[model samples]
Target: MSTTELSLAGSQPGGLGRYNRQAADLHYVTSRVMVYLLAFTAVSVIGFPLFWMVICSFKTSTELYQFPPAFLPHDWTLTNYRDLFIQTNFPIYFVNSLVVAGGATLLSLVVGGLGAYSLSRFKFAGMRTVSMLTLLCYMLPEVLLVIPLYLFVVDLGMADTLISLIIANTAFTLPLTMWFMRSYFNAIPASLEESAMIDGCSRFQAMRKVTLPLALPGLVSVGVFSFNHAWNEFLFALVFTSSETKKVLSLGLATWIGQDNIYSWGMLLAGAVLVTIPVVLFYLLVQRRLVVGLSEGGVKGE
Candidate 1:
């Protein structure tokens, strides 16, 4: 008799299960192929407009209005970009946007990181309530708060001030950032914090040396989220800022269109392309860290 162990409890070793296994493997492969195809389709649909806008940016105004649309420029020109620079306050709006968004992001990361560390590491009365309420606060829509926020800023004579915009953006961003960071912190073992504390480190020092380094990805992710929140913000800036010099990109871009006529379509598309580049560039720079942040922040990661 053969001495080798029977495979799959069949009469023969390593050969009894071929027919069923082969069919099942083929089905699994087919399913995976379908999944890949579906994902590719979804990605293509989502990215098409960005590609279309870029193509439109290079087309002449007359070409842009042509029927049946052209994907490639029959006659491309830099006129739109030139007009954007010369005729619009895009430069100041870009600078204001840079300052306001950068400042707000920095402020949110600082406050939120500290709050997250505290909430995750230390226990206190009403802590759970505060955690739950913080998320609820983020859920409070920007539209709902715009009226009160505008009144409050105007009363302080901060209308059109970048500081007002920065503060408002930071306030809107902080609660969510803290919660995101705190969830990440919760996943990190408390023992790590304890070890740092024992090694001549204050709680803050421990965070700086031990926790923060490990949580850099989470930091980057939250930073990206906060940056995007502060950057694209429209309603607050619209209602609060009135001066041409103070306007951010989202509002400033509106001036490209006149009440009576559509502005240069090519130039408008060009402006959009320029506005999109920075955020996309920022994400590309930090995408690796952002992935780590999301994965590490949740309990899903070890």
Candidate 2:
């Protein structure tokens, strides 16, 4: 055969070799696609209820309760939202939730960050033991602590106040906040603090200037987590407060739910959708910090 013909012939694969290679590539691509498809399917399945409720919030009362309840409304209206704003204390509940969650989250950051710093940096007798005990506190159920907390709040004259809820939520959230902050801080070098000390910076100033900037992402994660816990908290609010005016968004939703008025699904859904906006905004804003913190959060303490 000619050299050109031979070269061309050699370039063509035997059927079995080509088939095997093609099959292997196909298998790899198929598996990767399958993994992605499964994850997307799972998310869609999980998200469908929230999606349906949000869409239903735009429907009329008659349309919402008709037979099987429409999946997508033929007649979308603003009436349900109008009624929700006019007839309910949703705005008040929103404000109450914001204040309590904001207060608890901020407190957790300050207390937890300091505690985490102490635990990570200073070695003293019973430090490990104290940390272990705090870790246990993280596992302790809120329900178990309810009676004592209720009595304590009542004694302190804060039983129905937002401050009472903020304190209770902070107590539980602090340990978790401490652990995460400690882990993040542990990843930082001790010399950074020592150098600041050499430069006439106090321990507090060192932490405030050098460490705090680096640890901010961790602090943001801690704050967002604590805020979520305080905002959506139900049991304590349910048990501690009797006054409707003191009710949070979580408790207010339950008040909207009555046996005789199941047709208020539109109103309920509208409220739910409204409640989600602030949290979604929060997540969007802090999402960048979360990525940066968690990325650098794992390293051995020097």
Q: Give the winner by TM-score.
A: 2
Error of 1 at 245 (Å): 0.8
- Per-model CA lDDT versus the true structure: 0.83, 0.83
**Tens digit per residue, CA lDDT, model 1, 1-302:** 12322344366345555665677679989999999999999999998998899998988888888999988999878998998899878889999999999999999898888898889888999999998788778778888888898988989989889999999897778886888888888879989978889988998788788888888877778888788888899888888898899999988887666731546777778989999999998888787766765554333366
lDDT of 2 by residue, 204-295 (tens): 89989999999887788778877887988998998887687888999989776774264277788899899888888878878876565444
Worst 10 residues of 2 by lDDT: 293-302
